[model samples]
Target: MDSLIFALNAVMPIVVMVAIGYAIKRAGFMNDTVTRAVNKMVFRFFLPAMLFLNIYEISDLADIQFGYIIYGAVATILMFLISLPLVILYTKHQDRRGPLLQSTFRSNNALIGVPLAEALCGSAGVVAAALLSAIVIPLYNVLAVISLSLFSGNGGRPNVKKMLMDILKNPLIQSIALALAILGVRVLFVKMDISFRLSDMTILFKVLRYLSNLATPMALLALGAQFEFSAIKELRREIIFGTAARTVVWPLISLGIAYFFFRDTFTAAQFAVLISIFATPVAVSSVPMTQEMGGDVGLAGQLVVWSTLISSLSIFFSCFILRLVGIFG
Candidate 1:
C-alpha cells in the first residue's frame, strides 16, 4: 500500500500539471505558436540546464560503482537496439519512428526516478539513482538525438554526417559533456587541495537552478497546450504500443534479468535504481524533443500521457513483487 501510494504521489502531480496546461489552453491562454515557442525554449535551454545540474551535483564521482553503471548503460543501449527494428516495422510513418523509438528506452529518470529510489531504499537509493543518472541521462539524450535525427524525414535514408553533427550540437548532450568536464576539474581540484567549485559561484548556480526548475513544469504545460484529444484515436495504436513497452515490457525484461541473474551481486538499492530507470514512464521531455525534431508530436505527447498513467501500476507491482521475493527488503 505504501508502494502504491508512493507510485500515485510520484505520478499524479505530472498528470495534474499537464491537465492545468490543457485547461489554460482551452481557456485561450495558449495557442499553437506559443506552445511551439515554449517547446523550443525547453529543448534548447531549460532542459539543458536541468541536465547540467543533475550531473554537476553528484557529490563524488569516485564513489560510483562502475559495475552498476555499466549494467544500466548496456541495458539502455540494448533496449534502444531492440526497439529500433521493432519501431521501424511497427510504423510506416517516417516522423513517428523516432519518437516511438525514444519511448522504448528513455524514461523520466531525473523527474521521477530519484524520488522513487528514495521511497524504495532511502538515501542510499537516492545516491545510487543519482550516480546512475550521471551516465544514463546523457546516454538517453545522445541516443534520442540520433534516433530523432535519423528518422526526421530524409527520404528514409538518414544522412550520417548530419546525424553525427546533430548529436554534437544537441544542447542536452553539450550540457552534459560540459558538466562532466567540470566534474573532472573539480576532482582534480580536490586532489590538489583546492577549494574552488562551481557551486561556490552562487549567483550563476542560482540562475541555472531557476532554469532547471522551469524545465519539467513548463514542458508539461507545453505538452498539455498542444495535446489533442482527437489525436488519441488517430494515434491509438502507437500510444498503446509505446505505453505497454515503456511501463510493462521494458521493466519486465530489465528487472527480471537483474533479479534472476544478478540478485546476489547487486544491492537492494541497486535494484531500486534499476526499477527507477526501467519502470518509470516515458519522459515528458520527449514531447519537446519530438516537437523540435519534427517527429509526430501528437504521438509523442500521447505516449507521455498514457505511459505516465499506466506506470503507476507498473511501479507498484514491481515494488510489491520485488519485496515479496525478498529483493527489496
Candidate 2:
C-alpha cells in the first residue's frame, strides 16, 4: 500500500497533465504552433532548471555507486546494438530503420525516470539516475541523429563532431556542467550550509522548482496533444516493432543484463525502475527531431503516442512483478 501510494503520488500528476493537454487540444486551445513553442520553452528552460537544481543539491556523488553508471550505460548501449539487427529483420524498407531505431532505444528518461527515482530510491536514487542521465543523453542523441539521417535516406553521413558540439551546446548540457562544477567545488574547498530550505531562499528558487516540476506534465501533455491513434493503426508494422521492442524485449534484455552487474547494490525494485525507465516508448520530442533529420514525422508521431499510451501498463506491471520477486528494494 505504501509503495502503491508513492507510485501514484509520483505518476498521477503527469497523467493528469497529459489528460489536460489532450482535453485542451480537443477543445482547440492548443495547436501545432503553441505546442511547438511550449515544448521549446520546457525543453530549453524548465527542464534544465529542474536538472541543475537537483544535481546542485547532491552532496555525495561518491556514494552514488560508479558500478550503477557503468552497468546502466553498458545496458543502454547493448540494447541499442540489439535493436539494430532486429530493425533490419523486422523492417524491410530501409527508410523505416531510422525512426524505428529512435523509437526502440531512446527513452523518455527525463520525464519518467526522475520521478520514479525520487519516489522509490529517495534522493540517492535521483542523484544516481541524474548522473547516469548526464552520460546517457548525449550518447542517445548522437546515435538517434545518425540513425535518423540514415533511415530517412538523407544521403549525408552525420558529422560526429558537429553532433558533439550541438550536444555540448545544448542548454541542458550547459546546466548539468554548471551544476557539477558547483558540486565539485563545494565538495573540495567550501563548507556550505544547507541551513536554508529552498523556500527560505527568495521566491526565485521556489518558482524555479515549481516550473521545473512542470516539465513532465508539459512534455506529456504535448505528447497527448500530438497523439494520433489512426496513424498508429495505419503504420501497424512500425508501431508493433516500436511498441514491442521498447515496452517488452529491450527492457527485459536491459534488466537481465544490468542485474548481473548491479545485483549487490541495486535491488530488484531498482532494477525494475531501470527496466521501466528504458521500457518507456519513444521520447515525445522524437517526432520533431526525426522530422528535422528528415525521417517520417507522421510515423514518428504515431509511434510516440502508441508507446506512451502502452507504457503505463508495461511500467506498472514490470514494477509489480519485480516487487513480487523481492528484487525491487
Best candidate, lDDT: 1
Q: 133, model 2: CA deviation in Å? A: 3.6
Residue pairs clashing in model 2 are: 268-327, 268-328, 269-327, 269-328, 269-329
Q: Where is model 1 poorest over a 10-residue stretch in terms of lDDT?
A: 60-69
Question: Candidate 1 on 1-329: residue-level lDDT in tens?
Answer: 98899999999999999999999999999999999999999999999999999898888556667777899999999999999989988988899999999999999998999999898889899899989999999899889988898898886687989988988888888999999999889888899999887778999999999999999999999988988998988888888889999999999999999899898988999999999999999998888888878889989999999999999999999999999999876
Candidates' C-alpha lDDT: 0.92, 0.68
The candidate that wins on TM-score is 1
- Model 1's alpha-carbon lDDT is 0.92
Clashing pairs in 1: none
